[model samples]
Target: MNVVEVKGTELEDAFQIRREVFVEEQGVPLQDEFDGYDESGAAARHILVYYEDQPAATGRLRWLGDTAKLERICVRAAMRKFGLGSVVVKSLEKIAQEEGFCKAKIHAQTQAQNFYERLGYRQTSEEFMEDGISHIVMERTI
Candidate 1:
């Protein structure tokens, strides 16, 4: 398995995975999925996880002051059992550290809160709704 950093048109695979997981599978609106920061050149880094050369997961990281905001993490439904989700998050944290970020944070869906916790993220806020799904903020020092 390998996680790759992408930019410009190279982001298509990452976007495709996100659309598959967050939009079609989870019912998150398409508009809410691609939130425009990618086009803004905000220095956000996008990553794609490939398993046996097949794109199976994706995520992105953007600097938020002193912390790195981790978002859009998703593993293809068929690929979830292979531990690609952890691969994506670990890869993102590596990128964050490479970019001088010492902390990482996320707005994780309630159902996946435990998964994030296992990855060392601690809940930082009460449950909240985003795109009609319950979520909570989590953070960890990377």
Candidate 2:
């Protein structure tokens, strides 16, 4: 498995992975799963994790002013055992740090809070619902 920065057509693979996991599987609406950020000129940085040349996971980070917001993280269900989610987070964080971002945050689904906690993220907000799913805001210093 390998994780790397993606652009242009390569981002289609990222979107597909996200759609499979978030929209089709998790029931998130298409309108919520996709936004204008995927457009050619968006400031978001997308990352794709491929195993055997097939996209297995994906994520993105974008500047919300000085903070890097990590979003859209998803790993193929079949590839979850490989710890690809952590790999994707670390990769995104590296990119954020390289870009001079000292802080990173994510609206983490409640079920995945422990995963982010293990990676040094701390919950910063009360649990809330986003798109009908329980979530909480988390942050970490990269």
Candidate 3:
């Protein structure tokens, strides 16, 4: 798997991946899935993972003060269990640190809490519903 940071026109493919996983696959409302953040946020970093020349996974990073939030992480359904999710998180962490953020945060879907835990994220709050799915805030200090 290869992780690359891309923006502008290069982000189209990543947006498509997010639509597939967050909108189509998960039934999340399309309006909630793609937001204004994609256009106005200067600190937004988009990561795309390619396997054998095909896009395999996608994620986004948004710098908020001293912290960075990893959001909209998704792996193609057929690529689940192949470690692409972990790879995406690790890549985001590296990018955050490189950009001077000392901490990283994510609103992880409840079902994937254990996955984030294994990646060093600690649950920081009670589970809450977001986009009709249960999620919890998790954070990791780099």
Note the Cα lDDT for every prediction shown: 0.91, 0.93, 0.90
Stretches off by above 4 angstroms in model 2 are: none
**Model 1 C-alpha lDDT per residue in residues 1-142, reported as the tens digit of each score:** 8778888888888889889998999999998888777763657888898999998999988889999999999999999999999999999999999989999999999999999999999999999999999999999999
Ten-residue stretch with the least lDDT total in model 3:
35-44
Model 1 pairs whose backbones collide: none
Pairwise lDDT winner, candidates 1 and 2: 2
Candidate 1 contains a number of clashing pairs equal to 0
TM agreement with the true structure for every prediction: 0.96, 0.97, 0.95
Whole-structure CA lDDT of model 3? 0.90
- Show the lowest summed lDDT stretch of 10 residues, model 1: 35-44
Clashing pairs in 3: none
The alpha-carbon lDDT assigned to residue 24 of candidate 1 equals: 98
**Model 1 segments beyond 4 Å from truth?**
none
lDDT tens digits, residue span 38-103, model 3: 874465888999977889899999888888999999999988878999999999999988988889
What lDDT tens digits, residue by residue, belong to model 2 across residues 66-140? 899999999999999989999999999999999999999999999999999999999999999998899999999
Worst 10 residues of 2 by lDDT: 1-10
